[model samples]
Target: MEAAGCSYQFRIALLGDAGVGKTSLLRCYVTGAQGAAEPDPEPTVGVEFYSRALQLPAGLRVKLQLWDTAGQECFRCITRSFYRNMVGVLLVFDVTNRESFEHIQAWHQEVVSTQGPDKVVFLLVGHKCDLSTRCVSSQEAEELAASLGMGFMETSAKSNCNVDLAFNTVTSAIEQALQQGDI
Candidate 1:
């Protein structure tokens, strides 16, 4: 919905398996800081929110609410509750871990079942692209995005590779959706 002073606020959620660099991506995009290389970082207990204002193509100022959810099973109920309000969902997967990439489908299905198909903009992001030991190839990610009708990109929170592009891409999609009254 539109915020005060000609600004539109869009709520976006980051979803994936645990330890998939979701927090790192958020910190990189929102705070412009390189996230620490720590494992687990204590599983996200509930939903965490961060806001950033981005100027869109048509001179529209959009405020993005990046919601980072706990990937653990126990918090599924809490995370699921926020799904209805999300205008965009970034299905992030760790490039170094094959299982996280494989789980993208399940996460997509969950989003669809809970939030419906038309209201949510879906993006597939492969995190940790700077890691030399990549487990999931670009071809696989492209194919999955094509099969699911979503956009795909690789990002490195450490190197800041495609990190801004990924977030900007989703925000642009959300802006288009809002302009067309899809959200």
Candidate 2:
């Protein structure tokens, strides 16, 4: 169902390598509960969706259509098709997995090449922040985020830390960019 009074709808996608916690983050944000009912979520197939109505403090109401895309290489073809109309993308990576972090650039390039003129906003996210052993440091992620010309956030969907802030920050950025004709 559509949000009763939403004036805007933003289509956002979570892009990253497999097992980077995209679905967990989506579930946690939309359901306001733990990231998953099971401890280990079977990776998303092609693309899954979740929706939530957001009420910004500025009185802007929006319906967020969140897409959880499969990060496995085999499903890349399937996921790429959904990027066309996306207004924002959360480039996620598991902090404990260096390969996933390294793959972010390719994922980002795909979005840049596939989605044109829509001026989609991008955010680099370091997921699984609750884990103590991280192969990707905050400094490293920050620098990458800066180089990408986007914001960076570290969130733990499992612990519900910074999850809301991450989504809110990107959503608000998209809204601002749209209002200013930047996107």
Query: Which one is best on TM-score?
Result: 2
lDDT of every predicted structure (CA atoms): 0.88, 0.92
lDDT of 2 by residue, 69-168 (tens): 9999999999999998899999999999999999999999999999863589999999999999989999999999998889999999988999999999
How does model 1 fare in lDDT? Answer: 0.88
Please write out the lDDT profile of model 1 over residues 1-183, one tens digit for every residue. Answer: 344454788899999988898988898888787655534356577888888877788989878888999888888898999998889999999999999999999999999999887879999999998899999999999999999999999998888889899999999998888889888
Runs of candidate 2 with Cα error greater than 4 angstroms are none
| N/CA/C clash count, model 1 | 0
Question: Which residue pairs show backbone clashes in model 1?
Answer: none
Which residue runs does candidate 1 get wrong by more than 4 Å?
1-6, 36-41
**TM per model?**
0.92, 0.96
